[model samples]
Target: MSQRDLAKHLGVSLGGVNYCVKALIDIGWIKAGNFARNEDKRVYAYLLTPKGIAEKAALTARFLRRKMDEYDALKAEIEQLQAELAADGR
Candidate 1:
């Protein structure tokens, strides 16, 4: 997305998006290039590099695992509480 679009989507300031994008570029995780347009002569576009794609996939997996773990724990706790309530009612 454009920097402004990223900022809005991320709930951050435009300048913060610019700074983070610059850092991503420097880290070689993302590539940046100029836009070829009349009014956007100096504007840039960005895309993830191979490394960045892999990192994103890995992070997504980690997030999914963590979320699953949270869900399972909640489920177990609820079941235990339900069992206790049943026992108390007997």
Candidate 2:
């Protein structure tokens, strides 16, 4: 998708998308190439490098672990509330 489309889809400003894309390119995570034979030279296709894929996987794992920890804490809180209610005969 075009940068404008990406920005709209992500609910961010166009400049925000451009900044992030540039950062990824600079870090060797993603490569941006013009679409061959496309009339518009401004159009680019962003592809993830192998390093990017690995980074994404690691990020996903961390996100899941954090969410699981949050879930466990919430479950414990709920159980404690239920126990308090039972003790109060509510």
Candidate 3:
């Protein structure tokens, strides 16, 4: 998608999208190439590099682990609250 489209879909400013794209490109994580959409139009296509793929996988794993920890903590807290209520004959 064009940068304008990306910005619209992400609900962010065009400049923010532009800056992020430039940063990714600089990091060698994503590459940008131009393609012809029509006789008079050119559009850029961004593709993730292998490094980017690995980075995404690592991030996903970390996110999942954090969420699981949060869930476990909440479950323990709820159980403790229930036990307290039982002790009080509620």
Candidate 4:
């Protein structure tokens, strides 16, 4: 994605996206290549390496687990509040 698009979607600064992209390229996690946009200009494309794919999978798993834990906590809290309300009404 373009750095500007990425930054806007991520709700971060454009510079932050540029820095992260540079770091990923430096670490060999992603590669950047220029594609012809027209006769006069080119656009950059970023491709993920195999290592980057693995890392993304790992990160996704971690994020899923974290969100699941949060969901469980919130569910428990809601149930507790409902029980308290029921008791108070009785």
Best model number under lDDT: 2
Question: Residue 79: error of model 2 in Å?
Answer: 0.6
By lDDT, is 2 or 3 better?
2
TM-score of each: 0.83, 0.85, 0.85, 0.72
Show the lowest summed lDDT stretch of 10 residues, model 1. 35-44
lDDT of 2 by residue, 1-90 (tens): 888999999999999999999999999899989978999889888999999999999999999999999999999999999999999999
After superposition, candidate 1 runs with Cα above 4 Å error? 37-39
- In model 3, the Cα lDDT at residue 55 comes to 91
- Candidate 2 regions with alpha-carbon error over 4 angstroms: none
Provide backbone clash counts, one per model: 0, 0, 0, 0
**Better-scoring candidate (lDDT), 1 or 2:** 2
Candidate 1, 1-90: lDDT as tens digits:
678988999899999988988899898889988867658676776889998899899999999999999999999999999999999994
**Cα-based lDDT for every prediction:** 0.89, 0.95, 0.91, 0.90
| Candidate 3 whole-model C-alpha lDDT, 0 to 1 | 0.91
Scored against the true structure, residue 74 in model 4 reaches a CA lDDT of 100
CA RMSD (A), model 1: 1.9
lDDT (10s digit) by residue, model 3, range 1-90: 678998999999999999999999999889988766655455677999999898989999999999999999999999999999999999
Tens digit per residue, CA lDDT, model 4, 3-75: 8988999999999999999999999889988867555354788999998999999999999999999999999
